[model samples]
Target: MAKQERAVRTRKALITAAAEVFSREGYRTASLTVISRLAGVSSGALHFHFPTKSALALAVEEAAADRLRVIVERCEKFEQPEGPIRLVVDASYQVVEQLAADPVLRAGFELGGHTVEMGSSGRVCDLWQRWVASVLEHAQGAGGLRSEVVPGHVAGLVVAVTAGLEELGRRDPRWLAHPTLTTFWRLVLPQVAPAGTSVPLQFAGS
Candidate 1:
C-alpha cells in the first residue's frame, strides 16, 4: 500500500510538471527531460510512468476530461424541465469561466491546440462532443428541444461552437468577457431551445 501510494504521488507530480512545461513551451517544444527535472524525478522514473510524450499528453487530457465530467454532472443536478436549455447554457459558460480561472486548464488548452493531432489532447474534442451530446439528449427527452433536430447533430454544433469560443478565449483572454459571454449565451440558447421559451441570461461577471 505504501509503495502504491508513493507511486501515485510521483505520477501526479510528473503530470503537474508536464502540464506546466507543455503549457509554457507547447507540446512540440516541451521535453521529457525538463518535465522530469521539474517533477524532481529521474528521467527513468518519468519514463516508467509515461513511456512517451504522447502518453503524458494523453494523461493530461484524460485528467482534464475527468474534472470536466465531474463539474457537468454536478450542474446537471440543477436541471429544470421548463428551462433546461437555459440551464445548460448557463452551465456551459460557468464551465468555461472555471477553466479560465484554472492554470491547469489553460495549460491543457494550449497543449491541446498545439498538439491536437499528435497527442491525447485531440481526444479532448471528442470528449467535449460526447458531453454535449449527452446534454442535448437530456434536453430532447424533456421536450426542451425540437424533435426535427437530431441530438447528435445539435451536440456536434454545440461542440464546434464551444471549441471555437475556447480557441478565441485562449488567444485573447478578454474575448469572452462579461457582456460578450452573456451575448453568446443569449444567442445560442434560443437556437437550441423550443420556440417561445424565454432563455434565461446570466453572466459569470454578476
Candidate 2:
C-alpha cells in the first residue's frame, strides 16, 4: 500500500513538473531532463513512467483533458437562479478561470493545437462550441433567447471570441481574468437574451 502511494505521488509530481516545462517551453523544446529536475525525481523514474518526451506530453494532454472534463461537468450540474443563458455565460467564465489557473490545461491546449488529432473533449474549441450550442438551444426552447437570435451563430461567435481570448491570454494573463470576460458577457448578453429577460451580464463567482 505504501509503495503504491509513493508511486502515485511520484507520478503526479512528474506530471505537474512536465506541465510547467511544457507550458513554458512547449512540446518540441521541452526536455525530460528539465521536467525530471523540476519534479525532483531521477531520470530513471521519469523514464519508468514515460518512455519518451511524446509520452510525457500525451500524459499531460490526457491529464489536462480529465481536468477539463471536471470543469465541464461542474458547469453542467451547477445551478443558476436566473436561467440557462446565464448558466452558459457563467460556465464560459469558469473555463477561462480554469485556463488561467492550470498551466497544464493551458499547455494541453497549446500542444493539441499543433496536432490535427483531437484531444480529450474533442478539441477545446469544439468542446466550448458544443457546450455553448447546447445551452443556447436550451435557452431558445425555454423562450429565453430573442426571437431573432440564432443559436448556431451565437455558439460560433462565443467559441471564436473565447478562442481569441485564450490566445491573447498567452501574452497577457489578464485576458483570462474576470474583468475582460465579464465585459464581454455584459455587452453580448443583451443581444442574445430576450428583451427584459432578467439575465444579468455579470457572474457572481467572477
Candidate 3:
C-alpha cells in the first residue's frame, strides 16, 4: 500500500512539473532534465515514471482530456433541451477559463505535442462530440432546433467554434472572462436551440 501511494505521489509530482515546464517552454522544447528539476526528482527517477517525452506528453493530454470530459458530463444534469446548448457554451468558456487557471491545461496547449491521438486523444474528442451531438439531436426531436440542420453538422460547428474560441482565449486570456463570451454564446445558441426556446445568460450573472 505504501509503495502504491508513493508511486501515485511521484507520478503527480512529475505531471505537475511537466505541466510547468511544458507551459513555459512548449512541448518540443521542454526537456526531461527541466521536468526532472521542476519535479524535484533525479533524471533517473523521472525516466522511471515516464520512459520518454512522448509518454509524458501523452499523460498530460490524457489529464486534460479527462478534465474536459468531467465538464461535459456535468451538462447532462440540465433538464431543459436548451440546457445542453447552454451547457456546451458554458463548458467551452469554462475550458478556456481553466486553461488560464490550470497550468496543466496551459502546458498541454503550449506543447503542441499534447494533441489527441487516434486511440487516446481522438477517442476523448469523439466522445465529447457525441455528447454534444446527442444534445443537439434531442433538441431537434423536440422541435427546439431547425430540422434542416443535422445534429452531426451542428456538433462539428460547435467543436470548430470552440477551437476558435480557445485560440482567441490563448491570444487574450481576458477573452474568456469578458462579457463578450456570453454574447458569443447567445449568438451561437440560436442556431441550435429549439424554436421559441429562450437562451439564458447564466455566465453573464457570473
Candidate 4:
C-alpha cells in the first residue's frame, strides 16, 4: 500500500514538473534531466512511468483535458437563472479562473497549440471551440439567443475572445480575473440574448 501511494505521488510530481518545464521551454527543448530534477525523482523513476517525453507530454495533455471536461460538466449540471447563455458566461469565468490558478492547465493549453509529436488526442482549444458551439446551438434552440444570432459565428467570436484572453493573461494575470469576463458578458449578452430578454448584468457584472 505504501509503495503504491509513493508511486502515485512520484508520477504526479513528474507530470507536474514536466508540465512546468514543457510550458517554459517548449516540448522540443524541454529536458528530461530538468523534468526529473524538478520532480525530485531519479531519471529511472521518470523512465519507469513515462518511457519517453512524448508519453509524458501525452499524459499532461490528457490531464489538462480532464480538467476542462470537469468545468463543462459542472456548468451543465448547474441550473443557471439566465439559461444557456448564462451558463456559457459562467463556464468562461470558470475557465479563466482555472487557467490562472493551474499551471498544468496553462501548460496543457500551451502545448496543445505547439507541434508536439504526442498521440492523436485533439487539441484543448479545438475541444473548447466545439463545446462553445454546442452550447450556443442549445441556446438557439431554446430561444435564448437573438433571432439574428448565428450560433457558429457567435461561437467563433467567443472562442477567439477567450483564447486571446488566455494568452494575454500569461503576461498580465489581471486579464484572467473575474472582472475581465464579467465585463465581456456585460457587453455581449445583450447582443446575443433574445430581444425582450433583460440581461442580468447585476448578477454577472457585479
Runs with alpha carbons beyond 4 Å of true place in candidate 2: 115-122, 203-206
Q: What tens digits encode model 2's per-residue C-alpha lDDT throughout 68-181?
A: 778778877867777788778877777788888888778767767653342343455666677789888998998989989999899998877777777688788989888888
Best by lDDT: 4
lDDT tens per residue, model 3, 1-206: 99999889889899988887776767778889988988888999888988988888778767766777777666556665455566666566666677667777655554442554423443334555677788777667767676677889978866655555555665676765746567776776677665687866766776
In the range 11-118, model 4's lDDT, one tens digit per residue, is: 999989998888777888999999999999999999999998888888888788788899999989988777888777778878888989887877778877662454
Q: Whose lDDT is higher: candidate 1's or candidate 3's?
A: 1
Pairs of colliding residues, candidate 2: none
Pick the winner on lDDT between candidates 1 and 4.
4
Better of 2 and 4 by TM-score: 4
Off by over 4 Å in 3: 81-83, 107-126
Cα error, residue 25 of model 1, in Å, equals 2.5
Q: After superposition, how far is residue 194 of candidate 3 from its true place, in Å?
A: 3.6
Error of 1 at 5 (Å): 2.9
Q: Give the Cα-based TM-score of candidate 2 against the true structure.
A: 0.85
C-alpha TM-score for every candidate: 0.80, 0.85, 0.82, 0.89
Q: How good is model 1 by TM-score?
A: 0.80
TM-score of decoy 3:
0.82
Q: What is the lDDT of residue 183 in candidate 2?
A: 82
Score candidate 2 by lDDT: 0.79
